[model samples]
Target: MKKVMFTGGGSAGHVTVNMALMPLFLNEGWSVEYVGSAQGIERELVGSLDEVNYFPISTGKLRRYLDIQNMKDPFKIAKGVYQAYRLIRKQKPQVLFSKGGFVSVPVVIGAWLNKVPVIIHESDITPGLANRISIPMASAVCTTFPETAEQISKDKTHYVGAVIRQELKQGNRDRGRNYCGFHKNKPVLLIMGGSLGARKINEAVRAALPALTENFQIVHLCGKGQLDPSIGVPGYKQYEYINEELPDVLAMSDMVISRAGSNSIFEFLSLQKPMLLIPLTKQQSRGDQILNARSFEKAGYCRVLEEDGLNDASLVSGVMEVYNKRDEFIGRMRNNKHSDALSAVFRLIKETAKHP
Candidate 1:
């Protein structure tokens, strides 16, 4: 049997993307294995799969500042690579598919060094640093945005759009409403700041809740970090995070307020949900979120907001504007029903297996 190793972690975003493609791999009779950091959210997410083998390695984020922590990066990379080499040897996978994050860096490198073919999926308008560095070693690169292709080594990328969970392959507005406790009279505003949560966006939403509730119900995914019952605003429900319930929350929404992380943005787009996106700006390494937000805004799929200009009033008005023109905004999303990336990725895998 063909053995396929998948690497990614840090958030459900990465895990969900890999899960989206599992059925196709199974149909092709590929033995699926996963490699990611032991501590990331993927550990729990991966536990549910049957007959799947897993390998854990140490991986850490690269901070932009020059600090003593930077000194540990090389050593971590070496240890992770060694751990990954051992894991890949045991699994003996013929191919490795990576969704870029710090967790996948060593896995990709180890796979390449072991002569295992590597395919990387980058889910952003600009490639993540891990994927960017792995481009030279990758046998193939897949992307959600065609624009990202230019940034990679030429001819290495296939624009497949972003992969999304199977649940969102089609949208159910009523199911979404029911899942979020929609009363049917008020619009539902869905807000998420990625898996870790965004303090700025959460604060702005909390500050604006009084006005937001006047016209809509709110289903907020506060990333566990912002789950403050004390900030409880009527007409709003806060959850630390919900892995299995996202489809229902998204389906019931009239519009969304979120960060511009590629996974969230694409999931919103796939569901045809209108949104106001706040791109992360504090760190230089976060440039991709800004670019991803701008790309979607330019496509007229969502309204993009910069954190610098954000406030309770501006956020409320932005939501109102999108709600007022909801039909037009959602029209862009409706036109994107066939934007699933997995179909194209599977095709690539099929061809690679034959050629290799």
Candidate 2:
């Protein structure tokens, strides 16, 4: 059987694309394996899969700021690379596909050292630190945004657009409403701040609930242990995080207020959910979320609300504005012609793989 190794982790954004594509490879009689940090969200997401083997590696955080961990991290990364190199050699996968993250950097380098072909997927408008470092070692770079091609070699970049999970489209709206105990008379709004949840977003949304729930029923994914049981508001339901019920919840949602993670925003875009995006501040990140939000705003897919200006009042106003202009956003989203990204990416990986 043809063999493939996938690497990416640290965040759900890094691993989601791999999760979307793995089943395709499995169905085609390929042996699919994953390499990621053991304690990361990727381990839980990929390890649960029965068909794919999961390999844990010692990965260090690739932080930009100065810290004591910086001194120790290089050694950890070096150890990870060695471990990855040996694993890749033993597994002898036909190709290595990386969805850029800190863990992926070592895996990509190991694949390069072993003379194995590597394909990378970049979801943001600009490459992340991990992808930027690994791009030179990759056989091809697949991009979600057309503009991303400018940063990489013309010959190596392939614009495949967003790869959406098929399960998301198969959600049942009624099931979602029943789960949330929300009536269909009022519009449903989903508030999510990535997988880990955003403290600011959760606080702001909770503070604005009196104003928001008067117009829209809300389902809030407040991250793990972030839910406040003290807030007993009608037409509002809160969960620490969602899993199997996510698609159903999304299906019932008429609009969204979320952090500007590329994978999530694209899913919202694909579902034509009018959105108000509050991207993480530059202080909190590399300013990628800011760029992601701006790109969506530019395309008329959503409205951007930076975290610096976020407050209960602003949150309420933003949601009101998006709710009123929801039709316009929906119209524009419907007009967008999404390419078959899953097919294109699958084809790219197959073509890039070496014939055994």
Every model's TM-score: 0.93, 0.97
Clashing pairs in 1: 176-251, 176-252, 177-252
lDDT of 1 by residue, 1-356 (tens): 88788998877767777877766787777898898887788877787777677778888765567888788887887899999988887778878888878888899889988888888888877777777778888889998888887888767778888787777655567776666666888778888888878787888889998899999999888885578878756678888787666777777787888888887788778778888988888563558888888888888898888889999999998999888988998887787656647788988876775675
Q: Give the best candidate by lDDT.
A: 2
Model 2 CA lDDT for position 25: 98
Stretches of candidate 2 off by over 4 Å are none
What TM-score quantifies how close candidate 2 is to the native fold?
0.97
lDDT of 2 by residue, 65-119 (tens): 9899999999999999999999999999999999988999999999999999999
Please, what is the whole-model Cα lDDT of each candidate in the order they appear?
Answer: 0.81, 0.92
lDDT of 1 at 93: 84
Candidate 2, which ten residues in sequence have the lowest lDDT sum? 347-356
- Model 2: number of backbone collisions: 0
Candidate 1 lDDT trough over 10 residues, lowest sum: 169-178
